[model samples]
Target: MIYKVPFVEPTKNYRMIKNEIDAAFFEVLSKGDLIMRGQLKQFEENLAKFVGTKYAVGLNSGYDALHISMLAAGVKNGDEVIVPAHTFVATASAVVNAGGTPVLVDVGKDYNIDVTKIEEAITPKTKAIIPVHLNGRVSDMGAIMTIADKYNLVVVEDACQSLGGTFNGKRGGAFGMAGCWSFYPFKILGGYGDGGAITTNDSRVAKMARLLRYNGEDRETGEYYYHGFTCLLDNLQAAFLDIKLRHLPDWIKRRRKIAALYKEGLEDIEELKLPHFDTPGFEDVYQNYVIRTSKRDELANYLKKNGVEILIHWPKPYYSYKALELKDRGFPETEAICREVLSLPMNVEINDKQVEYVIKTVRSFFK
Candidate 1:
């Protein structure tokens, strides 16, 4: 079935910068700088500057970024890291991978970790708070930072979906001790494949992360310092990401425009709840334009039948997996959100006409 409005058009995204991407491939291929090369270093520098950090370490994936950040921050056995239950599984999995337990927290109406709930979750073992800036909206960093200071907890942001987003004039990852970003193809600053970075103002954290990503090797001195994982961001993928990063500002602008169109067309529908993109001091990039309605399944089926493709981000809670054994730890907001959230097509490539059709089709369903 052909979609009049598909969820994402990656091919079109590539086409928009095809010439530059092609050139980058040719340059990297001819030079044969396949791993830990100049291309990766340049991308890391560019990303660190963009995120307002003193240093950035490129890694293989967002999961690697988070895991290495935890390791660098001293998250160890018996440590518990606070995380919102609504984000992708990687956030918690990273904690577990770093020999820590993920203490689940619920999100507020904004679909970010509820700052009010964060303090209550802290314990003697609580080591860090991984505030995920989900759906392109920045979490309340001011409140989170205050809490972290009080408890002496490390803050490593899950800023994978909010590369260009900001709060109170400060970017997401900049506020935390360390921030983890993903370049998975669908993210705001995605690459052709998996890539990620850790940004930090702390030189210690930055240096440790850099070594941890390269399997504890001192490349210049040819020394193995400690046991570490081989998770360097490939030079080829880094080159692709660097090419795409230049266009990220415009991409973020277009996503917000699409979000505005959705809000204008659908705000009046009482049953449908839309995200607030115009909140003061917060620059939302609308990574995914998710709306909440009790009739989510019905609405999703209707949208698909009408050639408007959509997505439902994790229709179930992450703890639903029996193996994880988080079944007893129930988060009410997360459970309710899973039942109601529906993500309409949010591709930057979506045209106004396609957006209009999506709006019209959604309204028709409600009517």
Candidate 2:
């Protein structure tokens, strides 16, 4: 029996990049400025330009980015920050780390924060709202912003999985006051390893983030003034990210095309519920093509047995985590989606043959 191909493969440019990375390493070695050098400046500037933001502060991880952004947003002790119940724990944990309480809200059908319910959670103590763009799908920023304006709350967009996504002509990270991004290996615009950035046009917030990431040092004085985490990004990883950033547009296009193929193949299948693409004028980038089905475990096991690798984007939502466990949490839609959402093979490197195999395998499982 012939087994199906592997699910996803990264666009590894070793042949073209191994030498360049080596050169960068040697250059950094020669300069003896491996920590925060000119390369970091260039990477930060280039990233800001790409995201249409005035500044981009590189950090050790996306969680640090969110934590710093929360600090910049003034989410302090006992303040309530609303977050979607369906997102990764990092989004809520950042709020908690910043000494704020994260009130988990239910999501709508689009797998994003339920903007309709966000207003209901706002109180005098509510300071910020973290709208996570789960699976590269843009959240309803327009309505979210409207609600935020009415209540005087900050909108911190969790754009970790939406590096190349766009909403209403504006980039994903440029919508809110401050946007946090991740460069994890599996993300759309991933780096060599764990990395993250906070994008913002606000000069004050940008400066605070820069200082916050480096032990609150005064760049000019070169003196440690206040306490902050040592989350400065590695220059070597930034170099690799710069190279990958050049080809991100083409990769995004291919991912969108592949998503179209999946829609065409699975739209009529009664066993699965394909994600909705109702947000027009937004380039989603398709980070992970997730589908919901009642027979999720059976389908995943069947595909795995057939060599068609599949995964659940998240088996447990943020509220289910022990640390973030909420009291009397009730979200039927989130629980249902969590139990059923399955991610198929989706990447720029995926070929048409692989797409066909995935469709065939999924169909056979349902049949």
Best-fitting candidate, scored by TM-score: 1
lDDT tens readout by residue for model 1, 1-367: 8898888899998889999999999999999989989999999999999999999999999999999988887999999999998999999999898899999999988899989988878989998999999998999998999999999999999999899889998888999889999999998888888999999999989888878888898888878877998998999999999988899888888998999999999999999999974557888889989999999999999999999998898898887887875523668999999999999998788899999999999999999
Span of ten consecutive residues with least summed lDDT in model 1: 321-330
lDDT tens digits, residue span 1-367, model 2: 3336555555343444567767877877788777777777888898899889999988888899899989989999989999998888899889988999998889998788888888778889999999999898878888888998998999899999888777788888888889898988888878778999999999988888888888899888998755988898888778777777877888788888999998998888987888756657766878889999899998988988988888786897657756655643588889989899899988776679889889888888877
Candidate 1: what lDDT? Answer: 0.91
Backbone clashes, each candidate? 0, 0
Q: What lDDT does each candidate get?
A: 0.91, 0.84
TM-score per candidate, in order? 0.98, 0.94
Candidate 2: C-alpha RMSD after superposition = 2.2
